[model samples]
Target chain A: MLQFAAIILLMLGLYGLLTQRNVIKIIISLNILEIGLNLFIISVGYFEGGLAPIFTSETPANPNFVDPLPQALVLTAIVIGVGTTALGLALARKIYQKYGTLNLDEMGEN
Target chain B: MLDNIEVLQVLEIVIAVFMVVLAFLAINSKSLIKAVMFLSALSMLSVIGFVVMQAPDVAVTEAVIGSGLVTSLFVFTLLATKKVGVK
Candidate 1:
């Protein structure tokens, strides 16, 4: 069920990307899609009853902790998402400055 | 319990629906600023959904990058551009 919801979010983001003409909207949609993928990745590590992956002197040896790999992967993904958003917005600003408008169609006329 | 799972399923469905609606609005809204706001809202919802699904790290990242930095970037771009909607 969680996977299904993630897929739906992915599709919705894709639909927006394909249909939107505005550069900013396109970037937003892309972020939406990225979030969907992130959600899917994190959901993969969920266990019914898992402890946080921490170690202490009193910690038990029982291995019931959720996978930490996804957490690491998501940290990387978040950094990448920030970089991409910065680049996309910078490009949008340049597009706007050069064209004086945000509409792609209008900018294309130049 | 079965009831808990059922409730979770219902919550998931609601989140899915909200995501779809926000995605559509983000793309189709006439005002660029409004679209950006919608996108931010979508990101926030996704973050909440991630938390509910037991992904605290991802939820934190989404709230920070998706809702914080990205929204600011969009607003900056909006300010840079002349106010005009796609015809």
Candidate 2:
């Protein structure tokens, strides 16, 4: 069920991207799409009775803890994403200053 | 595997349809910005699918970087440009 919902969200983002002419709206749609994917990933890790993957001297024998590897990877991805977004934005700003428009049709690639 | 085959089959069908739709949207969009957004959405869906297949690390990365950071970058770029061309 959750998977289905995630998929729907993805579709919606895509639709928005394709349909929207404004650059900002397209970016927003892209973000929406990413959120859907993230939700799906987290949902996959959900086990009916899984516990948090924590370690302690007194509680080291539990075998039903959730996986921690994904969490770590996700954190790294988040940082990278931030960097990429910043760079892209910077580039966009530069383009705007140089060209003074967002309409791709008008900005001939000369 | 056979016991829950029916449920898995349903899931597979749903996922397949979703992917097809998203792929089309990403590539077929008229505007460059819209296309980028669709691409992000596609990335996110792939992350979720990975998680469902027992790959949590991939899911996390997709969620954070793909959705969060990438989108921001696209937005910034959009802001930089008022239109596709300089009028």
- What TM-score does each of the candidates earn? 0.84, 0.50
Each candidate's interface RMSD = 2.2, 7.7
Q: Model 1: per-residue lDDT, tens digit, B1-87?
A: 678767866887788788878877877888877888888998898887776666676678778877998888777767667553433
lDDT at position A78, candidate 1: 78
Candidate 2 lDDT over residue span B1-64, tens digit each: 5546566556656664676566566545566666666667666666655555455556666677
Question: Residue B69 in candidate 1 has what lDDT?
Answer: 84
Q: Could you give me the TM-score of model 1 versus the true structure?
A: 0.84
Query: What number of clashing residue pairs does each candidate have, in the order they appear?
Result: 0, 16
Please identify model 1 stretches exceeding 4 Å from their true place. Answer: A47-63, B1-7, B84-87
> Candidate 2 at B3: error in angstroms?
28
The 10-residue segment of model 1 chain A with minimum total lDDT is A47-56
lDDT of 2 by residue, A12-103 (tens): 76886777654445555655565555545555665534544555566557467666665565556556656655654675577657766554
